[model samples]
Target: MYVVIFKAKVRQFDDQYSQTANRMRELALTEFGCLEFNAVTEGDLEIALSYWPSEEHIKAWKQHPEHLAAQQLGKQRWYESYSVEVVEIKRSYKSGSY
Candidate 1:
C-alpha cells in the first residue's frame, strides 16, 4: 500500500471549493484506486491522507483533469501553501476489530 499525505494552509474558500472538493473525493474513490481517504481542518490548516494500492494509481489520480484544475484553483484561490508526500507503507496495524 501507499499513502499520499497532503497538507495545506487555507486561504479563502467559497461554495465552489466545497463542491469541487466533494467531487474530487468521489472521483478518487470511484475512478481512482483510492482505498481510503481522511481529511481534517484546524484553524486555517487542512490535512488530507489517502491510501492507494500503487504508485501508478496515485499518478493516474494526480493527472486527472478535474484534479489538475482543482490543484490550480487551490493554489490560486483556496490554499496559501501546500505540500504533498507519497510514501510506501511497510506495514499497518489495528488494535482490535472495527
Candidate 2:
C-alpha cells in the first residue's frame, strides 16, 4: 500500500469547497481505486491521507480534470500553502479489532 499525505495551510472554506471536496473524495474512491480517503482540519491547517494500491492510480488521479480544476481553485482560493508526500508502507500492524 501507498499513502498520499496532503497538508495545507488553509485560506478559507466555503460551500463550494465542501461540495468539491466531497465530489473529489467520491471520485477517488469509486473511479480511481482509492483504498481509503480521510481528511481533517483544525484552525488554519488541513491534512488529508489517501491510500492507494499503486503509483499508477495516484498518477491517474492527479491528472483527473475535476481534480486539476480543484487544484487550481485551491491555489487561487482555498489554500495559502500546501505540501504533498507519497510514501510506501513497508509493514503493517494491527491492535485488536476494528
Query: In candidate 2, what are the lDDT values of residues 1-98, reduced to their tens digit?
Result: 99999999999999999999999999999999999999999999999999999999999999999999999999999999999999999998999994
Which pairs of residues collide in model 2? Answer: none
Query: How well is each residue in 1-98 modelled by candidate 1, as lDDT tens digits?
Result: 99999999999889999899999999999999899989999999999999999999999999999999999999999999999999999989888795
Query: What is every candidate's alpha-carbon RMSD to the true fold?
Result: 0.8, 0.7
Q: Which 10-residue window of candidate 1 scores lowest in summed lDDT?
A: 89-98
What are the lDDT scores of the predictions, listed in order? 0.96, 0.98
**Which parts of model 2 are misplaced by more than 4 Å?**
none
Clashing pairs in 1: none
| Per-structure clash totals for the candidates | 0, 0
Q: Indicate which candidate wins on TM-score.
A: 2
